[model samples]
Target chain A: MKSKAKDLTDEELHQIVEKAKAKDNRALGRLCEHFYSKIYRFIYYRVNSIEDAEDLTSEVCLRVVKSLPEQKGLFYAWIFRIASNMITDYYRRRAVRSNVTSTGDLIEEMVDEKRTTGELLEQQELRQAIKHLTEEQQQVIVLKFIEGYDTDEVADLVGKSAGAVRAIQFRALTVLRNMYVRKDGKS
Target chain B: MEQNIELLLDNCIDEIRKGKSIDECLADYPQYEDVLKPLLQLAVQIENLPQPNPSSEALSSALINLGKEMERNTAAAEISEAIVPSQRDVLPQKGFAASMKKRKTFSFFSEGSFRNVFRKSKLAWALSTFLFFAVVLSAVTVSANSVPGDILYPLKLATEKVKFFLTFDSYGKAELRLNFSDKRLNELVEVLQQSKTLDTSLLKDMLDEAKLALEENEIPVEKASILTAKLNHVNAYQKTVLENIRPEVQATDRKIVDDAINVCDMRSRWMRRMMNEEYQEQYDEQDTTPQSQTPNRKRHQPKRMQWGEGCDWMR
Candidate 1:
């Protein structure tokens, strides 16, 4: 669905979203398919397990489909907000926020054929370092960088001001840079 | 200010997303390049982190589940719509939440509406069950006082039949039947008192029940005395009651009344015979005198009244 989503213009995407809001199943399927990879990646990077990300992604999609009719604002914001909430609920239910990203599991998640092992290891380190940031900082980094959502959009999804989102992004990046420097120095 | 540099870093990241080189933007803010470059490069690398696609199996399964849920919801909405047409306009505006709320509020007669409807129906069923028992109890109560032609009189008869069958012991059954016979006589009197035409069949039934009570097979000897005494008393009362009502009967029904009196008379004779036999047996057992001198046992005999004198003989 995300593959199909890449080829479609903004207008076509908007039409599909509108049809989904009207309970058109085909359009809803397209919408879910389009966001599936993105939502999965968003959850996967934040959570420790691939299964958890897949489950949370599906949950977020279903909630979006059900609540679409009553949705009043931007669809992206609404959907990401649902995904964010699902992740929070997952952690709350588990009662422990474990960041156990084994190299074997990270290697399995590498879908890109051209990515070198060094890049993969770097990405893994980035993911591990991201977990050490505050919850708000992690959300800001994931929303702002990984999802490529603008400051205002990230702020809307996370229920904060644009200025706050910007500050969080900066602090999150600074912390990550420090972690990378320390790791390099230790090596 | 630290806040300014944060804003500037965000501005540079926005430029990088828009295709401006990160190094070109860092050059513009030359003084903060050292602090901002690593952060910007890390941000770019994090953004470059490979996005994972959901497995096709999981995606399709999730989609199928979503479709099924939507179908169920649509079906529910259609049923809810059919039940309450006025709320149709509200469903589209407020969606499933509003439709469900409307259903709870207005779907009184819908079979599949809300849990509360089932609860209300259960309460109704309980109330109806209570009402049914109450009606039966009231009918039995009313039937207790009903005469032959009253609406509830059949109920009274059925109740008596139930009581008769429920009595397991033969003596108890006979007693109950005899009591029923007495009730019939009372009803006959009540009919006469009200000047209603007496049902002759009812009178016959009463006599038949009395005969059955006195003629039950192999009554125990111990209970026989008590049963015989009760029969004698009932027969006397029946004869007196029959005689008392004879003048009140119309000329055409007088024959049936006479027949009833005759049955009462026969019952009295049979009772007297039984008593005589019993006394004779006792005398035979107690006799210590010679058999030739037994004729003198007339001195021990109790005085008996003549049967021709009617109920006065029984008293």
Candidate 2:
């Protein structure tokens, strides 16, 4: 049922893109509703603050609206590309301010109320481990596993070939497995 | 071996994610179970990790804000379109010589087949002429009231450049430039009076232009006197305007305002001296106290002098 619903949205995406390009506010609103949670989740995992994630998500939506007229190609890939660039810029600015390269440190500073102490600790460990991966590897893992993008969709998004994406995913997962075992041994 | 195992594991994970049991997926890749089992299990765990989702309230608020922004952009565009025709209609027709010169300039560009084509159709010629002048005039009038920080300020300066180009005489050009300088001062005063922050750089540019005009010494004495009088009139309100703006004025801007006031005073004094000299000559020529002959003259003299003195006191 979930896959069917996902397929339904995927089919409607083309019409949604057309209406949004025509500046139909209702269509844009629907697009925002459909993508907001996914975009927010993507940003939140990297930035680790609900407030910053929400703000960045809003910025992404605004950019989508502004650039929709000139944008072509797959809507999903195009929208996520905007998201990816905005996140990179956000971190670059943050790095300039704090003189730090690790976003995981910033994530640990956030006050998340949704998770218990153990869950937060575990999530933090996961985030830190992911942060240690190369940026491409991290993007692959996030897009493939968390956001549930298929291999080809991930390839189109990250501008890599399918084989490259698969390789990146494999490497990222292997790194996570090693890190998970090491952390389990420590605990 | 490594590449083959990686592909098999990748396929197994895809099947497992699509709702096939781990047992079923491994059955097809039993040779690589040692490599696939832990990797697939880790992938499953990672996929099930808690991720952040935007609250519904945040989503609704963002959508509302985006709607407001879109509405603002639409309204602004509509207002600009509505303003264009009315602005064109209000522009005063150009004088004959100015219009002819403009036509000559256009003809200069309309060389080759373009000129013949333009001349062939009387209606097209008339339409193009009207459009040309209308666009030029509308831009000027619309930009006239634009303050320094406004988007139209550059257009306002460009219109002044066009005026300079159209003026035939040197002194006329100087006078026009001086008037633009005065216009800037007035805009500054108006903005200051409204308790809005003035663009200090524009104020400085205006003062510099005024000073440059005075130093050029090309303006006729009578015309210079008129300009000086206008400056003095503007300066009269400067004190009140400055008082309103004092708290907001930074050190750099305060210096600019002070320099502008000083320039106004210096010009006013010179103009007053020139006027008194002219009055003395006229009185000498009359050889009698003509106060009885020109009753209004006696009253105007004191009033004009008093206005100059008011500016002096403010300085």
By TM-score, who's the top model here? 1
DockQ, cand. 2: 0.17
**TM-score, every prediction:** 0.51, 0.50
What is the TM-score (0 to 1) of candidate 1? Answer: 0.51
Q: List where candidate 2 sits over 4 angstroms from the true fold.
A: A1-8, A96-116, A185-187, B83-315
What local lDDT score does residue B176 receive in model 2, on the 0 to 100 scale? 72
Give the alpha carbon lDDT tens digit for every residue of A39-92 in model 1.
887787778877888888889888887788898776677787788889889989
Best by DockQ: 1
Candidate 1 docking band: acceptable
User: Where does the lowest 10-residue lDDT sum fall in candidate 2 chain A?
Assistant: A1-10
lDDT of each: 0.73, 0.65
Q: What share of the true interface contacts does each candidate keep?
A: 0.57, 0.43
Q: What lDDT score goes with residue B48 in model 1?
A: 70
**lDDT digits (tens) for residues A69-159 of candidate 2:** 9998878788888998998999887883222224553344455444566776676677667766777887887788778877887899888
Q: In model 1, what are the clashing residue pairs, if there are any?
A: none
Top candidate (lDDT): 1
Tens digits of per-residue lDDT for model 1, B185-242: 9898898888657777668777767777876655665576667778878888998988
